[model samples]
Target: MDGALEKSISFILFIIIGIILKKKISSGDETNGLKSLILTLALPATIFIALLKVKVDGNLVLYPILALGFNVILFAFTPFLIKFIGIDENSAKDRSARLLIPSLAPGLSCFPFILEFLGDDALAKTAMADLGNKFFVLFLLYLVALKWHYKNADFEANSLKSKLKSLFKTLIYEPVNMFIIVALILVSFGITIDKLPNFLSITLNRLSFIMTPLVLIFIGLAVKIKKQQFYQIFSLLILRASFTLFLIVGIILFVDITIKKDILIMIAFTLSSASFWPFAHISAVHFKEKRENTKEKTFDPNFALSILALSLPISVLLILGILTAGNTFTEINSILFLGTLLFLIGIIFPIINKIKKFLSKTTKEIKPITKKKKIQLIADK
Candidate 1:
């Protein structure tokens, strides 16, 4: 009966329908085709509308700065966090986790819900936040990954300038970025969405309408993760989220966020799924390592795929649940409890595995002594 409840249910239903249709949508290209539409057409349109609708100002730049700050913080701290999962330092899998855990792909995982629940103003804010995340994942992570590649492959870094220049081109030509720039230019010239010609404004609105359902279904269709890699990625993702919650709590404590929805926007945007761009960087490095015939590789591409596959559902569910709960996570104490709870959940399995190993070792030791004791007693008799 309630509006928010209705929207949440519809989204869940779309995702469930996607999961059900996964069998029919068997090809990767089929999924990619859907993704192409979302990224190039639907998603960009939605973001364009959101941006145009909002008043542009100098203060908006702070969103990207803050988002970039979060990325750097996560990157610095992730090495320590991955150690909890027994991911050996400097291993291929370890490197893959490090590259992924900090990047944010909010378009597919975050924006739809923000639009549906938090409204366009919040979505506009989040779109700005994503700009910083884009730079982190695209340029910074590439450099970091390349450094790792050089370390393991034992080759001097080459063509970095060419690669970085190419990434700059990608950053410019990307459909979302294009729309954002156009929208800003329009806003600067004193033109808002309502001020635009009826034909142009109406078309953008129609395109924005498809973004939510399309994303929800794509998430549904893309939901394929192996059981073996599930636990490790799942735990790490939870820990990542827990840390993000802690950060948001700390920010709210100091920053003056008067709006409740704004806090939710920050939480939801930061909790987005790991970007697919980092995987592209990993793939490129893998290709180079192969050509150079390097024995020690930089990243495990399979491991990276596993991380990305599992990330979407986990982040979607988390953002959805927290947003659905409304102001529940707005308080400091509630968020603290959530962060601590997630942190404990992340470590519990590793702790259990250690206890199991200890018990098995104790049993093995006891069996040998028991056998010796029985033999001695029998001889005496």
Candidate 2:
């Protein structure tokens, strides 16, 4: 618990420091560059390092299938649920997007943490599971959902084909995938690299350390909560949380897959939050559309930010509660605790923003009276 608490605190501190430094040193371009680094470099490296040494087994192989199956079930049944709930088509598409997009990086988000907690063997199995989920999301659900959302627009097919091509390109170029392939080839031939020079291993290990916190901070930096969209954002958060919880329970009960408790916690964490990348993509697309129309668009930065911020803490707490409640808090407790800490750190940004907004408003109101008094004094002079 202490270690987890410390990790949470450290996560919060680093994010705050990053945000502050970003404000001072990072222009919009720099911030964008930071995002690019996370997506292209840090995240992929982390995934590769974590999965490279992992050992896969039959149970591990089934986990991703179960994850993909659950996602498929959600995508198929959620539309019907939306229809029954009387949500409009546009709203249903948004709901589906929220549900489907996060499945893309379940492994990326959870695998490193799982590796830290469970070890290479568990991570390898989890990677296999993650690989399945990523393939299903990127290739299947992502394309289908994009088509559903944009089907009626002019140039729909062209747009869909473009998106499919983008997805394929992403898959082909992803460092994580390349790493997996290389690692698999190595492992298949019984070529052991674990005995590699200590210095290189240390270097890779240090690089891997940068991956998780950088990602969490990137998530924090990306999500900016505004005042007006609080209610709507909160509702969406509840929707995501509810859906993830339901999926977790269903997989545990109905699925024949057997994973260790730590892995289960990782799966729960991975599925529980929406993917930050898709939100960035959606936001970018919306921004472009608004620009082309020559109309100002109200993009809800806070909505996704709030969702991510809230999801982290909830996931950490959920993981901790489950572990502690089951009395299964073994060696992995440190990792679970760290995860919870990271989430708690995530929650603070919104709170800080709210406070800053309140103070800014108060200062603005006070400034008018001070200006009036100064003007009156000048007249008297």
Candidate 3:
């Protein structure tokens, strides 16, 4: 718990610094540069290091599959959740949430905590889990965005094959993917990061060290909030948390994840923040379509931004609480903890609305005496 708290505090401090820099210095270009540093250098180096450290085997294979299974299941269920929350099916939020809510962004939010609290083995497992999610974000979500962009339009008119080819090209050329490919080859031959040349290993270690602060600061710089969309974002957050809680309970009841450390990892993974890459891909499509003067609404940038802004704090608090509890709580207590949270979020808003209405009615019912009536009463007296 202390470790979790310390890590959380440090993470927030970096984010706050980023926010201040964005406000005072107009670090827009700098922030973009930092993000490029992350995607092109820091993140890829970090991934390669993690991949090389872990033994590639049957248990390792289970991680990506488990992660992908979670993504797919959540994806299948999101539409119903969207409908339940009363979001308009035709709205841009709907389109974006379908992609955003199901994906996991452990790199930015979860990794630092794992490193600080659970050490490298846990971090390795988390990184492995993230591979499946990365695949979804880079490939499947890209196709979904393209489809939404050209849905009503003719495929031949837009040269769909060329568009897809371009998309695939973008995916393959990303430094992250390239590094993954290289790392896989190395691991296949029983190589590890330590076996690399001294200079290369030192340089990579330094780059990877910057990953946490740089990513957290970039996230802070990128935080843009829309007041109108806040409620929708909150609803989506609640929905995500509730579903995750349900899954946690299911795991406790049915699964044999007996190791406390593993259980903690699973809980944290289940509650990881939604990834930003899907939003990035979707935003690119929207921007390109806007340039081309396409009339169809593509994706909602505001909605995506809202999710990004809210997900960090939501995920941090959940992880912090779980970690502070220290994996000692019984299964019933774990269920009760999540159940209480779910209950509060579900019931609080309606109760507040009812209270507001009652107060309004009571205020309207009481009237002030008019001057004429007061004068008549005084004269009569």
Candidate 4:
């Protein structure tokens, strides 16, 4: 087998192992423990090494801007799709969908795969892209969620300065962000991974080594989706991913992405799973609603949970499948075909439900009358 196919098999096997081990893993806490290790240690080290390995130039500035722009587009597009899907406007579920669909969580979902498949340089580019996403998720979306809270309840938001200050602190203090900043600073000077002390380099590389396996296992163990909202969530995620592909296709047509690896990076990075931060924002609002003793909520916790639970696995499948395909999806026609296929896939269930409803209604309208019933009616007359 080719190298790509072989690597893809290994990744799938690791995930399967995790799923098998899920039977032995008793609690959410264990999954959380593994996640903590990845986010705090392995992921950061991986990003640090990736960034150090690459040459960070001026064009790198556009990455975050592009990422943030994609978020805004998805945010704007979500409501129309939600309404078209027959959800009630401004309802808890609608609000939750709006917040979660647009946000990208590359740390857990995309980074490891990028490193393994696209190499360190591509991973570095994706890491830079996450900075803008972090800002959007941490600050802008937080404000939106807070506004939602204040709209429904009697609460006050702090001054912009205070909120910005706190958010700035939160951004800097995060392990991933810290590693990114440090790596960028080192790169700004004349330092590369090779220039680093041998001991530190060895340790970081070792930590990075465990990231891919740990992440895949966590995905297998952690994905807890209920059947209640499966179709809705699955359909929404499909539409979300389809829209993402179309958007990328538009860009590829206009922009100059020559390298297959670069094109894969664009596809994989933009298609990262929905961020957990939005759900955190949703939970914060839920907490305040509880404290205020309010009957109504700003966002549906269960809906948000459903989105988060299913997003990673779906995105993992997508990113893995796309990246593994190598040059198959590098052209415009292939991408358009894939996106169209996903769009159709997303709409098929809803269409089937509508058809079922229509058939039922028509059957009810045309009730068949038997000869005995007709004779009985004539006799009564």
Tens digit of lDDT per residue, candidate 4, span 1-381?
Answer: 645345555765777788789889964678657766876798779878977886546878899899999899889999987876667898999999999999998876788778877888897789878877877886689788877766765435556676567556656776777898998899899799999999999999999999878866765666556664688788889988999999999888788777888888889988888886686577656865787688888898667867876787788888878877878888889899999999999997678777987999887766655556888899999
Q: Rank the candidates by TM-score, best first.
A: 3, 1, 4, 2
Pairs in clash, predicted candidate 1: none
| Model 1 Cα lDDT, one tens digit per residue, 83-110 | 9876889899899999999999897688
Give the range where candidate 2 is weakest over 10 consecutive residues by summed lDDT.
294-303
Residue clash pairs of candidate 4: none
* TM-score of candidate 3 against the unseen true structure: 0.77
lDDT of 3 by residue, 42-110 (tens): 878887887788765567888888888888888888887776666778577798889898888886568
lDDT of 4 at 16: 76
Instruction: Show the colliding residue pairs in model 3.
Output: none
Q: Indicate the residue-level lDDT of 128 in model 4.
A: 79
Backbone collisions counted per model: 0, 3, 0, 0
Residue pairs clashing in model 2 are: 4-337, 4-338, 8-341
- Tell me the lDDT of model 2 at 114: 51
**lDDT tens digits, residues 29-103, model 2?**
766677667656665556556555656576777767756775666566545433332334555344434443344
By summed lDDT, the worst window of 10 consecutive residues in model 1 runs over 150-159
TM-score of each: 0.70, 0.60, 0.77, 0.70
Query: Model 2 misses residue 122 by how many Å?
Result: 7.9
